[model samples]
Target: MGRGRGGEREREERKRREEEEREEEEEERREKEERREKEERREREKRERERRGGETGGEEEKRKREREKRRRDRRRGGEEEEREREEERRRDRRRDRRKREEEERQEERRKREREYKRRGERGEREEEREK
Candidate 1:
């Protein structure tokens, strides 16, 4: 009974705030729906493009490009493998040369030992005859 005009003003202000809130909610819902629709449309378009590509032998073209790249890579790999084989051959040659040199050195040492043994036997024989 006492609050007449003040109550009316308060009611009007509350109603305005609620209406603004409802509008914001509606805008957010619309934005979400629009984003979903856009995403669906993009997916549909991508599928259609893929189907068209299949029909036009675009997949074959892609495969051809891939094959060409693999062929190039294999060619390069073959060159690298040849280089590696050449290096291995060089290493083997060096190893064989070292082995031959070592054998020659050992033979020289055996010859020297034989000569020294012969000289020692000759000296012993001479000493025994003197005794």
Candidate 2:
């Protein structure tokens, strides 16, 4: 009976150690799973941040392009306005020159008419003195 009791006690002790070892292994497995989950979450968050930054960079580039286009258009408009003003000034100069020429021509015509009238009057006086 003493030997049987010793054997039974040893069996119970072995069973308890086995159960404790299994519990420890299970706890380690749970810890590993938690670590893996945390790592996966961190990777997902990093990816999201990178994607958001890329989108912001794209938007900034688009805004810069729009501003450059607006500046180019404004420059072109200013050049066109300057050209129009220059053309108008040239037209005004031409009109002034034409008017001056017209006045000179009228003055010459009046002088010629007055000289012809004086010659006619002198010829009439000579004819009356001879008669």
Candidate 3:
């Protein structure tokens, strides 16, 4: 009877220890699942933030392109103005050249008229001397 009681006590102690070990394993599993859940949540939030940032960056890039387009348009307008000014300068130079040629022609004509008058006076004086 004493031996039988001792054996029963030993069995009870072993069972309690097994139960405690199982409880500890269950707690560890719960903790691991909680940690995994938290990590997943953090990753999800990070992805959302990254997506939001990417969207914002795309919008900013679009805005920059628009600004660049406007700048290019303005530069094109300035180039057109410069071309027009160059055309106007060319026209002015042509007009000045024409005016200069007309002035020179008129001066030459005056000199020829003066020379003809002087030659006529010399001829009349020589005819009188010969007579």
Candidate 4:
């Protein structure tokens, strides 16, 4: 209704708009910082992967050679891998058999010791009876 009242309302609206603008600017600054941090992380990860790949080149070449050798063997219908596997199994079985034999021998020795102790106890009792 009055010029002074209208002026006062205008000043309040301007202040509210200025506060909203400040908040929007702050939000934009935060978003920019987040984007920069994400980009840095991605770059670091990419560099790390490149370094690892370079380090693994020798291992990759070794694996490639092994694969090629296996392919060649397959083409020739060679049983080299199977023969090696069987040999390993045979060695394992021989080792297991030896272990079992050793255990049995130790068990027999323990049995003999127990039997001798029993005989000695009985002989002592018989002597006491004779006394």
lDDT of 4 by residue, 30-88 (tens): 65786697689669857866776677568776687579658856853544565466557
Q: What clash pairs does model 1 have?
A: none
Indicate the worst ten consecutive residues by lDDT in candidate 1. Answer: 19-28
* Number of colliding residue pairs in each model: 0, 0, 0, 0
Of candidates 4 and 2, the better by TM-score:
2
Model 2 lDDT tens row, 70-102:
986897698669757755765675576567557
lDDT of 1: 0.72
lDDT of 4: 0.71
Q: Tens digit of lDDT per residue, candidate 1, span 1-131?
A: 74696578658856865765686576568657866976896698578658757676666867875786688588768856875775576567557656865875797689789989999999999999999
Clashes of 3: 0
The lDDT per prediction is 0.72, 0.71, 0.72, 0.71
> What is the per-residue lDDT of model 3 for residues 5-110, given as tens digits with 9 covering 90 to 100?
7678659856865765686576568657866976896698578667766775677766875796698689769866975775576567557656855775797688
To one decimal, what is the Cα RMSD in angstroms of model 3 from the true structure?
51.1
Worst 10 residues of 2 by lDDT: 89-98
Clashes of 4: 0
Instruction: List runs of model 1 lying over 4 Å from the truth.
Output: 1-72
TM-score of each: 0.45, 0.48, 0.48, 0.42
